[model samples]
Target: METEDMNTDRVRHVLTSLMILSFLIFGGLSAIILITDTPLTTSSVSLPFAFLFVSAMTLIVTGQIDERPKLTKKYLRQWILVCVFMVLVAALAFTLA
Candidate 1:
């Protein structure tokens, strides 16, 4: 049980880190866009928003799972999904660019 709790904590930590990274990236990009007055219609402009969306989803999932005990499997599942989402978003961004 202790090990499961530790694993849950680790998962939470990683997701929280990712959320922070997403926020940083989004904020930096948004600042750049605003400073340059870049048009939102550009394909690359969506990348930051996509990352922000993923982080929001991550936050929601983390909050939901925090209320449950012995949900290590669910944590792993959520981690995998979030990773896949970030990868997909990156791939889309590259393809669009």
Candidate 2:
């Protein structure tokens, strides 16, 4: 049915979002670690928030993909929150370190 297809698409979207998140989180962190020989500090805390933003942006982007109604708002708000949190973390990290 059409509903089933839509549901499947939504699931696919969420999965893709998660995959993208992992890339930004694990991959970015690994790269950062390799580049900088330093232990994690508050400065690194915003990294996860950035990852969330990237993943949310990915969902919004990529040529108009279908979104589930329930997830749409959740993801949007999460992105916003992450952005704000990242900003705070970056500031604190720099000052503290």
| TM, every model | 0.77, 0.38
In the range 1-97, model 2's lDDT, one tens digit per residue, is 7786687567557757675765668577767766887676655645654565556555553223353544544655665576567657756766686
Residue-level lDDT tens digits of model 1 in 1-97: 7887887888788878988888888899889889988877646576777777777877876786788746757766876787677768776875777
TM-score of 1: 0.77
Question: Candidate 2 versus the native: TM-score?
Answer: 0.38
Report every candidate's CA lDDT: 0.76, 0.60
Model 1 pairs whose backbones collide: none
The predictions' CA RMSDs to the true structure, in order, are 2.4, 7.0
Model 2 weakest 10-residue run by lDDT: 61-70
